[model samples]
Target: MNEFLAAGLVTALVAGFLGGGHCIGMCGGIVSALTFALPPSRRHPARIASLMLMYNLGRISSYTLAGTLVGGLGQLLVSNLQEVARILSWLAVIMLILMACYLGRWWQGLIRVEALGQHLWRYLEPLGRRLMPVTHPGQALLIGLIWGWLPCGLVYSMLILALSSGSALQGALLLLVFGLGTLPTLLLTGALARQVTSFFRQPLWRQASALLLLAFAFWQAMPLLGFARELPF
Candidate 1:
């Protein structure tokens, strides 16, 4: 793969990892609740792992679908207005920087951005409620699909990058990697909620992740300035 695409994938992964705090605040409760929803007899480690895996698969699947739709729109924009596509790519970098700031606790403007999705989430939340007390993996998966639509600034920031990708497949892959990146923290949340939360909550780690993300955003934006062509493998 070209370096540009590779960079994008890596950026997505890092963004997801850096956004662990946001995930914990947003989905941690639901994750714990889902675990409790499991039958008493199914609370063993193996069973819990299997169910959490299903839930994440469903969540990531939704992200991929969203990426495809937005990426297809990006493809059309690239075909019709190359300049506009370039502008959006720059916008994506700016959004990434803002994401880093948010992660670093430097600014909270992104939380306001999350309000943009609340109306839509209001509609989808009821559907999720109907799937309550997830009894089986299938039910967990369905609930997860619904939960994925929850309003989250971090997810919205990544969606901007996906939209700027200018290709459906690339956008899907980007989001898939991002989703995988989040797997480690979210997967462990059910079993080690306190430890995972505490680790991500550390200021040093958050600052480091945010700085790395800022560097990535700069790298992504550099090509637009004609400093380097998309590296050919």
Candidate 2:
């Protein structure tokens, strides 16, 4: 990938990592439901891991699909490469700032943005509900497929970033990488799940993650600010 694409991918990755808190808040109940829904006999580590893996893969696939659609739209609407680059650059920084606000719970204005998605989510949610008590990995996977459309500001932010990519393939890759970045946090299960989720949920941790993202937002804006995108050190 070119540096532009590389940077966007990296940004997506970091955003996903930082979104661990949001993920838990958004999907923790569903995850817990899936866990408890399992038969006691199937609660072994190996089984849980497989189920979570399948579910996440399904979720990531949905994200990739959204990226492809949005990126294609961007391509059709924008006919200039330089224009795409500018859009990508500006959007990366803007999304980062918004993300920082989200991570810290400083501003919930993003919740308003979720309204745009609620219409689609209502249609998808029932399908997911039907898959409840995920008795099998397949059920978990199916539920994930449907739940991926859950109205989430973080996911939507990443979609906006994907919109700036202006290439369907790159947009898909961006979301794919983002999904991977979230894997570490979302994969948490058993005792580790509580410990890690608790850590990410703490005010200190959230604030720290938000601050880091803010620094990153400024770093992304360096070029636009008339400074070298890469400091010579």
Number of the top-ranking candidate, with TM-score as the measure:
1
Per-residue lDDT over 2-97 for candidate 1, one digit per residue giving the tens place of the 0 to 100 score? 665788898899888878887888889878877788778878887777778888988989888888888888989999988988888898999999
lDDT of 1 at 87: 86
The 0-to-1 C-alpha lDDT of every candidate, in the order given, reads 0.85, 0.80
As for candidate 1, its clashing pairs are none
What TM-scores do the predictions have?
0.94, 0.91
lDDT (10s digit) by residue, model 2, range 1-233: 57556777777898889888998888777777766777888788778777787788788889889989987776765665556657765876787788899889898788888788989988999888887778788988888888778898888878877787778887888888888888888888422768877888799989988998788778777767888665322
Off by over 4 Å in 1: 229-233
State, as a TM-score between 0 and 1, how close model 1 is to the true structure: 0.94
Residue 136 lDDT in candidate 1 = 77
Listed per candidate, the RMSD to the true structure in angstroms reads 1.7, 2.3
